[model samples]
Target: MNKHCCNDMTYHANFKCDIHKDLFECPDKLIFFHERDNDYGLIIHDGGSSSIEILFCPWCGKKL
Candidate 1:
């Protein structure tokens, strides 16, 4: 697991389940962290599997 700015960020980023096919398949997943891009995003549950890149941590206010 990657280190995040705070517990909230870490918790949300690490929350995952094998039962779901992907991030979009899990409705509880609201925050996403892209390992390759090294960025964070707010997951959009619009059935398009799209997300909005976020620059800072919503919980800690730290630059992501």
Candidate 2:
């Protein structure tokens, strides 16, 4: 599934799910590193393991 970010990055501060319209906070970390043309990706911590996967926002239950 194609991942989607919140329309407003600060939505988590208010504890509101952008997609579900419920009280929740997104745990997905925003990646600042850019490769080319302002392309970016999210960083999901995996206990320092080589395995990495883009997880969904637990609050909204949507791909992050």
Candidate 3:
């Protein structure tokens, strides 16, 4: 997996919720990383998996 700009970004991108046990299964998953696209996004929990692409790290302001 590609390294994220910050630890917070990394953690969120690979989030494993204690309740859901998996990022994909978590209803509150916030950040997302697309390996194929090599980009990061903010997850939108609107009943389906959707996200808004983010250019900079929300935690560190680093270019992603």
Give the winner by TM-score.
1
lDDT for 6 (candidate 3) = 77
| Model 1 bad stretches (over 4 Å) | none
Q: What is the overall TM-score of model 2 with all chains considered together?
A: 0.23
Better TM-score candidate (1, 3)? 1
Question: For residues 2-28, what per-residue lDDT tens digits would candidate 1 score against the true structure?
Answer: 578899999899888678878877898
> What order do you get sorting by lDDT, best first?
1, 3, 2
* lDDT (tens digit, per residue) of candidate 2 on 1-64: 4223553423332333356432212344334223243333343445331222335543455554
Which pairs of residues have clashing backbones in candidate 2? none
- In model 1, what lDDT does residue 23 have? 84
Give the Cα RMSD of candidate 3: 2.7
TM-score of each: 0.85, 0.23, 0.77
- Name the 10 consecutive residues with the lowest summed lDDT in model 2: 21-30
lDDT of 3: 0.81
Clashes of 3: 0
